[model samples]
Target: MMPLSMVASGETVRLIAVRGGRGICFRLAELGLVPGATFQVIQGSGQGPLILAFGETRLALGRGMAHKIYVESFMRGGQECQNN
Candidate 1:
């Protein structure tokens, strides 16, 4: 797993876990960020807040906070998941 801050732009990733305190977790969850949710990176390069698209909503997450979010490729295996 990798931090959300490291995910390449245009990649769709699934949230795995949060490695922060309760307060932080709650705050992020309130913004629609939680385990199992999927998100696409708009901008991320291990610097600054990450600009991510969570469905129709756009979220800007600070680098520190972004680092707390662990994710994996949303696609199963090495292939991209297809839309039905």
Candidate 2:
């Protein structure tokens, strides 16, 4: 799995695992970032916060927080790949 921070804008990815303390994990879960959740990266790249869209909700995540979340990216052509 790859860190969420590595994903590019417009890419859709499924939440894999989170790497951090319990508090952080709980907070992320509260924001709908639990494993198996699929979301699109609306804004990423550079050092700014990432804008993620899932359903009708959008979450702006900082680089540090993004790095703590791992995800599986679904590539084009119906192929799923893990980039770590």
Candidate 3:
């Protein structure tokens, strides 16, 4: 899996796992970024900030924070694949 920050705008991805401590993990979870949740990359500042959408909720995540959130890109015709 790759970091959420690496996903391009308009890309859809599935949250796989969080690879950080409790504080970071808990914070992301509270923001609706949980395992198995599908998300889309709405906007990215390219300098760290990114807008992520899951269901109807949107979240702004920094590069450092997003890097800890492991995600796999979703393809329309088949199973999801881990992003590099």
Candidate 4:
């Protein structure tokens, strides 16, 4: 899994894990960032806050916060990338 900040814009990813303290996890969970949640990266340029789209909802997360969240990027059709 890679940090959410590393994902490129327009890429869809599934949340794998959130690394941090309980407070951080709770905050992310409140924002609907729980594990297994699938969302698209609206903006993740590795600079500034990363914007994520969850269906009709969009959330702007700081780079630090994004770094704490790990996700697996999808290739297409919501399929997970296979290691080669």
Q: Among these predicted structures, which one has the highest TM-score?
A: 1
Off by over 4 Å in 2: 75-84
State the TM-score for model 3. 0.81
Each model's backbone clash number = 0, 0, 0, 0
lDDT of 3 at 52: 83
Give the TM-scores of the predictions, in the order they appear: 0.85, 0.85, 0.81, 0.85
Between candidates 1 and 2, the one scoring higher on lDDT is: 2
- Could you tell me the lDDT of residue 15 within candidate 1? 83
Q: Which residues of candidate 4, in runs, are more than 4 Å off?
A: 76-84
Task: Name every residue pair that clashes in candidate 4.
Answer: none
Candidate 1 achieves a global lDDT of 0.82
- How do the residues 1-84 of candidate 2 rate in per-residue lDDT, one tens digit apiece? 678999988999888778889998899889887777889999987788999999899998889989988887755322343322
lDDT per residue for candidate 3 within 1-84, as digits (tens), equals 677878889999888888888888788778777787788899853775898887888887788887778777777423543422
TM value for model 2: 0.85
Residue lDDT tens for model 4, 22-69? 998889889787777899999987689988899799998899988888
Clashing pairs in model 1, backbone N/Cα/C closer than 3 A: none
**How many pairs of residues collide in model 2?**
0
| lDDT string, candidate 1, 55-83, tens digits | 99998888898888888889862333221
* Ten contiguous residues minimizing lDDT sum, candidate 2: 75-84
